[model samples]
Target: MISPRPSLAKRAFDVAASASALLVLSPVLLLAALAIRLESSGPVFYASWRVGAGYRRFRLFKFRTMYPDADQRLKDLAHLNQYAAEADAPEASGEGCAACAALEEGATCSPVLVGDGGEVICEAEHRRRQNAGPAFFKLQDDPRITRVGRFLRNTSIDELPQLVNILLGDMSLVGNRPLPLYEAEQLTADGDGARWMAPAGLTGLWQVTQRGTGEVSPEERIALDNTYAESHGLGFDLRLIAKTVPALFQSENV
Candidate 1:
């Protein structure tokens, strides 16, 4: 089982660092907020429900990086989703494997899975179907982003407001990133859920590992998150923070 409470050193560091960042970056925050407001007709800050450690839900704050109608515009841009299923992928027949089908009674697929329509599927097929699409949605050159928003995203200034979440003990300076509600829901399986073992954070292993390599597959992202969850500590977090400094300047928009 994952520990819900972080070590004293980790917690202490998060509190001190987050508070200091918020104080020192206050001017930048205000400027970003003003820029967002001037460019769009919505709240300067956006708060979306995110799942954190132990599957707890909290509102994650960010400088608004999309137009007010961004969510409404999502459906129109489904084709652009970087994680969407490939158009040429073969259809899943949902048929039992030959071995399992031959057994007629008693035995079943060695590793079984339940599907969305309440059907049982073998592991290989289940994995194939799952890998056919990703739970998280992201897009490169998303049309919903404003000019100012694009700058903020490129510089990651939009993520600075999450310092408040860290200050409030809702996150850490380094841990697996919190997931949006929809993303979190799709990650409930044991393999995927392993990511929830760590506290949510402003940045973490996957973000740093995938830096500048715009081709992070969903499975790879989750594997990195699981790695961090299994091994993060005060010293490791410090190392990640140091690496994060240089990563922040990378041109990769996501």
Candidate 2:
């Protein structure tokens, strides 16, 4: 278990700060949601269950970035992305909460739009491609992004709904970033599996350190996250949050 977590004052600060952020950012969020629905047919908000504090699971909200059935397609490709972590760490896989993990390979669906009156858009599970022939794994630059999607992601506007997670107490303003179930399990064998000890956050130490850095191996990423957890405190949280400001302007791979 994590030796100890942030102090009550810090935790309270996170709650108050996130709440205030949500209130002030509400207009921006609503506008973004309207843009998403205009260009796509999916819901204004895309909610996925992500690993959270205390190793718990919580639905994370994001502006939809892919085709609606992306979940099913992911399901079909499960073996590869699942065991993709490594060959020997463990021989088991957990069923993803999203249907993407269940869709079979070779299945193809015509491009569909998410909104009624916007740009042409199609949400696909496999649109991770750039110039065809299998898509690239990306922290950013997904080929499937719509014109508006591109703008939203680059500006980090797509993450606005997460303010709800903070309000619900399912997330924090600063902490380790959350992981997909598959990524969580894969990192387990990579030196204590940093995910096991870290609470999912909207921002964290890794976010700041990794800014302007090149492709990071999973090992290095885990190390940064663990270090944050090891020394977390009220002052440290404030420091990291402050650092994240300038880091936000830096172009990160994600």
Candidate 3:
């Protein structure tokens, strides 16, 4: 399916906002680069392959927040993933959840299931079995994060380099957050590929609404991304941008 064209006004806003921010924050960006260099022995920036609207691939830039060998260490730290541990945990009834049921039946399970009580139930274990891991991985205290990395991640200074992405038309200031290659693959396998129709951004509805909260599962994040893709407009984008500022100050870092 073809992705909808972004509004010209939105593109105009992205250009203006990103350019102005980069120009005004040049000194701060430089200092961040220097800090990363001083503390690490690798490139100052990390360029990750990300899936954007229409499954378009692009390099998303961020100030390096982890050691150079961080990716290599992911397998060794698999046990430390909070989501993975949750999936492995016994349910309240000391039985397996939907994920286990589906896996036992040799069938795929939905990423989310709504209980009769309206609680969001996750089938992360099923996803892990099918996709080899959770779509969204977060560790509360990852050993891979350097001292400087933690501070940069907490303050979100590491994200400043994304302004260049916006300026280059690779992303917008307000849209659905781009997914990493691995995460995108799982979402596609689950029939949630429509979410990729949304423009990629540095901040979006999910980030503003559920930032730093562990309650939101990967399925919920995909649902929110699809919802924004379907309903977002100039007014909604502006509102999300307004909310993002305060959301950043929240104690949780997801």
Candidate topping TM-score: 1
Q: Give the deviation of candidate 3 from the true structure as CA RMSD.
A: 6.2
Candidate structures ordered by lDDT, highest first: 1, 3, 2
Cα deviation of 49, candidate 2, in Å: 1.5
lDDT of 1 by residue, 1-254 (tens): 56756789999999999999999999999899899888879999999999999899999999999989998998798768776643213333344445565666755676878888887777655656665445778888999999999999989999999999999999999999899887888898988888888988899998887888887877788899899988888999999988998898888865
Per candidate, the number of residue pairs that clash is 0, 18, 0
Top of the candidates by lDDT? 1
Q: Write candidate 3's Cα lDDT for 1-254 as tens digits.
A: 33545788888988998899999989989988888899989999999999888788899999998899999998888878877666555444443465455564444456665545765445553333344566778788888888888888888888989999988888888888888887777777535876777788888888888987757777788888888888766788999989888888876675
Q: Per-model C-alpha lDDT, please?
A: 0.84, 0.64, 0.79
User: Model 2 off-target regions past 4 Å?
Assistant: 1-5, 73-140
Q: What does the lDDT come to for candidate 2?
A: 0.64
Per-model TM-score on C-alpha atoms: 0.85, 0.71, 0.84
Question: How displaced is residue 107 in candidate 2, in Å?
Answer: 46
- Residues 151-181, candidate 2: write the lDDT tens digits: 7776778777787787777777788877666
RMSD after CA superposition, every candidate = 4.5, 14.7, 6.2
